[model samples]
Target: MKTTILPLAALGIALAVPGHAAAKSGDVQFKLLGTLVAPDGKITSVKKDLIGLPAGTQTKADDNVVPTVAIEYFLTDAISVETIAGVTQHDVDGRGALAGAGLVSNAKIVPATLTLKYHFGKDGGIQPYVGAGPSYYIFIDEKPGATAVALGATRQKMNDKVGAALQAGIDVPINDKGLALSVDVKRYFLRTTAHWYAGPTEVLTTRHKLDPWVISAGAAFRF
Candidate 1:
């Protein structure tokens, strides 16, 4: 009779289990992700002597796919914090008759973001959330390699940047063990001042606005 009662209690607990859900008090997650960024506009440089290029010197921005890794810690079932990092490369093209004369070089932008997110609907195996936070950008590899300048070179000066980020995502849980798949989208509003140094003879400067859209897909696990 005692053995029969113990087996019955264990069966009841199993039958009473509910749908997949996040942890109640504390959980940590790690994820690997990739993002596709679409640059909103052409690259504009504000420097002295750069405006004199041939009318056909075409300047444009490039949108490339980037991969990232992030880690998150959940304070409660409803709230979490995450940090992610990614980078992309871009090139300036020379076109028209002045194609040979304008600055054509490569540069990169690296962004690191810290986000705070709010989760919703965790009891049904589908969790959706929205988040907002701040980001830091570092510009590198600025070289005046080639173009039509008195010194046959050009240089870009970009300041370290601070900006705002917003993101939304949904997670699909696979089981009670906290394994899930996620899809997310994020946008950043960033501003920068570009300065170009063209040889000893010239300099140019311009203020530009950068609003980048990013889409990501990844897998996550809770511990």
Candidate 2:
């Protein structure tokens, strides 16, 4: 009689389990997102010229729109590891004295970030999360623009950078089929060194602080 009762109790418990519990432990999530990267930092020229030019010539980078993707593996219901990748292009121009001179240079950046996230939620409801991690950026196709060419700048190059990344976002379940809509904002503290030929004989060097905020929104799938 005890064995018959035990089996019935197990069956009832299984039937009462919520379907959203499928994302509980050891789940992997994939997201395809669109991102806007807006630069919010300054660029300063470090090497002062012999002609006694200003000590810190400043510049600003323009904002960009790009496509991004992220993959997350849940270590537990509240903890996960995520990696995000995206490619973006930006136009850099001078400020202050060189302002309105048009584009100084253009560069394509591919950034990959790995983060550990902490999420707050129960099974299938809205999940809000925060993450922090490190990001690696590869700068490619650094080319001189019209302004740079007019200033006799040639062979421009931007150094690759590694920086800290911070993120915050929420995931709202759209249906019971392991699908959710996600929105997140991330900031990166990135700095890089720039080298270019001011002329056929002169090489100009500077350091740029390219702290950018990335806002993303998209759909995610949990399995």
Candidate 3:
């Protein structure tokens, strides 16, 4: 009878294991995925006078669309860290109305960001998150036409920018492995000191303000 009772007790313990696992499913996990960032923002600039000409003018930096790839890691049930990188290309219209001379130029800016995020969800429902952080920008490949009266149009190299970021998003789960679809929006506030070398007799510098808003939709996986 003792031998019979031992086998029955073992079967009962085996059946209880699934219940224990279900209770512990709350353990932490990591997530990895590819995301796309579409940025929409306005550019404004401050100009200074040159050669006794009334310079010191501040104008819009130019408008453009930039694309990027993002990565994020979740540290706990409600916290995460993320990074995004991409390049931006835009055109300066030489203050069209200010310069009836018809001048236009192009500039390229690349932005990279790091953020801390907080997530919300209960019982595996839809999770929404928000993030705030800092961004670093690099300006390159600037070309301004000779007719550009804004000073150092072609001679300017606005290589660096520093700013802050604000973001919000939601994720919809698809399975137990933590596969989900995500949608997010972000805003970056930044500025740059634009400098140009115009021939041997001219060098110009200006301060620019750039604020870009980005919206992204993509798929994510958790491990």
Per-model lDDT:
0.69, 0.80, 0.60
Clashing pairs in 3: 43-61, 44-61, 47-56, 48-56, 49-55, 49-56, 155-196, 155-197, 156-196
User: Candidate 3 lDDT, tens digit per residue, 1-223?
Assistant: 9999999878655433221211122333333333333333222543643533234333454455544566676666578788876666765434433443223346766677888888765445567788999888777777654556454444546657778999998876666666667787888887676555557544555555567666666676655
Per-prediction count of colliding residue pairs?
A: 10, 0, 9
The candidate with the higher TM-score, 1 or 2, is 2
Output the worst ten-in-a-row residue range by lDDT, candidate 2. 48-57
The superposed Cα distance between candidate 1 and the true structure at residue 46, in angstroms, equals: 4.5
Query: Global CA lDDT of candidate 1, please?
Result: 0.69
What clash count does candidate 3 reach?
9
Those runs of model 3 whose alpha carbons end farther than 4 Å from true positions after fitting are 1-47, 51-58, 99-104, 145-154, 201-203
Cα lDDT of candidate 2 equals 0.80
lDDT for position 88 in model 2:
90
Please tell me which model should have the higher lDDT, number 1 or number 2: 2
lDDT by residue (tens digit), candidate 1, 124-169: 4467899999988777884443653444445666566899899999
Per-residue lDDT of model 2, residues 1-223, tens digit only: 9999999878655433246553566999999999999985376546534323344456888899888999999998789999988889988876777775544456899988999999986565678899999999899898877876766666778889899999999987777778888999999999988766665554566787888999999999988
Who wins the lDDT comparison?
2
